[model samples]
Target: MGDRWHIEVDRSICIGSGMCVGHAPDGFDLDSARQSHARATTADANEKLLAAAENCPVEAITLRLADSGETVFPPED
Candidate 1:
């Protein structure tokens, strides 16, 4: 089995840019309020999803290791 990732979007930070959807349409979507949200809370590790997280202008998208809870996107600094 490969790694699984847990995805989250901080609505407080999301600007509804739709950048994530543009990068990975299947991974994210905008709500009626125009906030971005994950299509699934957890998913198989995939590059497109990573790009979606990386491209989020507000850094609202977050990806973490499902089993370990390790940060994947925005780096842990």
Candidate 2:
């Protein structure tokens, strides 16, 4: 689908493993403090983002398609 996708990370569940940032630096970034919380900066669906979500040990990252109801684990990749 061509629709934009959004990603959300639960800070409470995050462990600051940096897997999200490591896998998809363009989609996610850690604060200057490099804490457990990470921010989603991109809204495009891509394999990199999916890898990031999958690499998270805590499974705190979530990827969703904004224009469609479709959702996937590791973001369809």
Candidate 3:
């Protein structure tokens, strides 16, 4: 298993907050639906990527360990 990660956004919970975009412009964007969407599936999950998820006002962003399908942010409660 590698350290790659997959990013996802729950549109049902998103509030159009631009923190994710501001923190990681290349990682996420507002689609026509006005919801956050991943620019790429297997992203680098760099500091900005994590920050984008971390700064999401609605906590709608989620990061998963691609190789293991483990949730890394907002944690798995």
Candidate 4:
């Protein structure tokens, strides 16, 4: 199984509020332009990633296991 997790965001739904970056700065960043969208540049899966996905106001972010293509959310406690 791959150790990395992939993050995908729907740019059409993203409002560019910077919440994802604020929650997981290492995994996501917002482009500074008109109709900007947050982009996922890293594939690090951790509690922080889960937090960022959950904190997204528009629920634009999707998290998946890179190897198995399984969704990982509402993280295990």
- Candidate 1 residue 34 Cα shift, in angstroms, is 0.7
Q: Model 3: runs farther than 4 Å from truth? A: none
Any runs in candidate 1 off by more than 4 Å, and if so which?
none
Off by over 4 Å in 2: 36-42, 74-77
- What is the Cα-based TM-score of model 3? 0.89
Better of 3 and 4 by lDDT: 3
User: How much is the lDDT of residue 25 in candidate 1?
Assistant: 92
Per-residue lDDT for 1-77 in model 2, tens only? 56566677888777788988888877777776655443543476778878888889988887777676477654466
Looking at model 4, the pairs that clash are none
- lDDT of all predictions: 0.94, 0.72, 0.85, 0.72
As for candidate 1, its clashing pairs are none
Clashing residue pairs, candidate 2? Answer: none
Q: Against the correct fold, how does model 2 do in TM-score?
A: 0.76
Please state the error at residue 28 of candidate 1 in Å.
0.6
Give the per-residue lDDT digits (tens) of candidate 1, residues 1-77.
Answer: 99999999999989999999999999899999999999999999999999999888889988999999999997997
lDDT of 2 at 57: 96
Clashing pairs in 3: none
| TM-score winner, 1 or 2 | 1
Model 1 residue 23 CA deviation (Å) reads: 0.8
